[model samples]
Target chain A: MLLSRMVPTGFNDLRREMDRLFQDWMPGDGNFFRPSVFPAVNVWESGDTLYAEAEIPGVTMEDIEVSVVGDELSIKGTRKPMPEGDYTFHRQERGTGEFCRFVTLPMPVNAEKVEAVLKDGVLSITLPKAEEAKPKKINVRTS
Target chain B: MTTATAVEKREGKVRPEPTRGGRIYSPNVDILENREELLLLADVPGARPEDINIQYENGELTIHARVDSRTEVGEAQFLACEYGVGDFHRSFQLGESIDNSKIHAKVKDGVLTVHLPKTEAVKPRKIAVKTA
Candidate 1:
C-alpha cells in the first residue's frame, strides 16, 4: 500500500510551508504536542438534551473518562499502541497516545441526568437541559 | 495553480458515494508486514460491523463504512460541531505479490483488520546444502 504522499513543489509547496508554520503554534501540551487535531468530535442538540459524539477507536471503555460540570463537558482517554515485535510497517496513519477534548455546551444542561455510552469505538454523551434552560413559547393575542 | 487543477480533476473523476448524501471521510489505518502475511488495522469509529464494506478488484482494495446519526435535525439546538459524521471511504492499490484469494477481514470495537498472506512463490525458501 502507498502511504507517503508526493512532495509538493512551487506554489503548493509555499502553501504547505505556511500551514506548517501555523500548525506549530497551535495549542498543545508542550512535550506531547502533535500537529493533528486528535480524535474527531461532533456536538449537537436534540429536543431538551444536548448530544456529543467523539470518534475514539482503539481505546477501551475502561480507558475513557467523562465528566460534566454545568455546561462544560470533558472527555479523557488514551489509545494504546499495538504490541511491538519484529514487524515492518508499510503504513502508519493511526495515532496512539493520550487525548482530552473539552466542550462547553451552548446552553446550561443538568449535570445530574447526563448519560454516556461507548460503542463501536465511539463515545456518545447525552446531557439534558436544565428546567429553566428549555425554550418557552409565548402565545400572542390580537384584540 | 497546476497542482490545484490536478487535485480538482482527481476529486471530480473519483468520488466515493456516501449514504444519505453524508460527507466522505478517511479512517486512520496501520499496515504491518510480518513473515508470512501483511496485517492492516483501520480505526472506523461509530461504524458497526455490518456497516463496513471491503472490496478488492484489479489490484485495488477499498473500505467503506456508514456512520450512525448523532442527533436528529431541526429538533436540536445549534452547538459546537468541529467534526462531522460521514461514511468512511478509502482505497489502496496492491502489488501482484499479494495473494488476494487468501485475504481475510474482521472487525471488533469499530476497528477493522485485513490479513493479506504472501503467495508461496514469493515467500522466502531455505535451500538445502549438498554434500559431495
Candidate 2:
C-alpha cells in the first residue's frame, strides 16, 4: 500500500537532484525512502547515553549489525524476501531490499562500548558517552 | 422495480474493492506520565523490544516495528490472521516544549516506551502566593 505524502519544504531541490542524476537514465518514480519495506527504527538520548532501536521482526542476532564512528552512526542489515511456495496471491506490499541508513547522534558516542541486543524481531543499541562528554556539576564559589 | 434490477444497479454503482491483506498493525499504545519523565508504551505482538526502533531526528519522533516470525503468504489453505509480519510506522511532532537535551526510551517484552522530560525551565511547577 502506498503511504500518503504531501510535499515538504524545498521539495523542488529533491526533484532537481533527481533529474540531474537521472536525466539520461530511466526516471524511476518509486525509488526513495519507502518506509513500508524496511524495518522502523527509533533513537533517543539521556544524560550520557544515546539509544537506537530498529525493527527487524523475523531476523535473528546474526542478521543485524550496529556501529558508531565519531558522531555519525550507521545501522545496516538485510531483510530476506519471503520464500516461494503454495501461497495464493492477494497482496504483497512489504519491501525486501538491502537497507542502509546513516544517522548522526547529538553527542559523540562511545563506539568501543556500544551494546546491541536483538530480540523479538527488534534490535536495540546503547551507545555510552565518553566520560568527558557527560554532564558535570560545578561547585559554587563563595568568594 | 424488480429485485434483479436493483441488485444489478447496486453492483454497477459500487467501486471495485482493493486488496486488504497488505497491512501491519501494532496493538493499542499508551504513553504515561512519571515524576521525572514520561513513558511511551506500544504493544507489538510477536516482536522483541530489541527489534523495535525509536529515533529523534531534530524534533521529529519516528517509531518502527518489525516482526520476523509471522509472515503473509500469497496462497493459503486455511488462513486466519490477526497480525502478520511487515513494517510498521508512527511519528510525532515535537517543538522546544520537550527537553531535547534529556530524552530517553526503552522497550521491554513487546511494549515500547519513550521518556521525554520537560526541560528544566518548562517542567511543571507549583507556586505559592502570600496572603494579601
Return the TM-score for candidate 2, rounded to 2 decimals: 0.43
Local accuracy of candidate 2 as per-residue lDDT tens digits, A1-143 = 22212222134236435644665664444435323334444566655676666655445556556778898778777655444333222222233556675767767877899998876545667889877789999999999
C-alpha DockQ of every model: 0.40, 0.03
In CAPRI terms, model 1 is classed as acceptable
In angstroms, the error of model 1 at B42 is 1.5
Candidate 2 CAPRI classification by DockQ: incorrect
Winner by TM-score: 1
- Indicate which candidate wins on DockQ: 1
Q: Which regions of candidate 2 fall more than 4 Å away from where they truly are?
A: A1-37, A84-88, B1-132
Candidate 1 lDDT over B1-132, as tens digits, reads 222233223321234654476566666678787768767888777788789889877656778887766677678665665556667777666555678889999887778888888789877788999998
**Interface Cα RMSD of candidate 1:** 6.8
Worst 10 residues of 1 chain B by lDDT: B3-12
How big is the positional error of residue A23 in model 1, measured in Å on the Cα after superposition?
12
Top lDDT model: 1
lDDT digits (tens) for residues A62-102 of candidate 1: 89999998778899888887757666776566777788878
Q: What tens digits encode model 2's per-residue C-alpha lDDT throughout B8-84?
A: 23221222122343344423344444334444445454455566777766555557666553322332221112123
Deviation in Å, model 2, residue A47 alpha carbon: 2.4
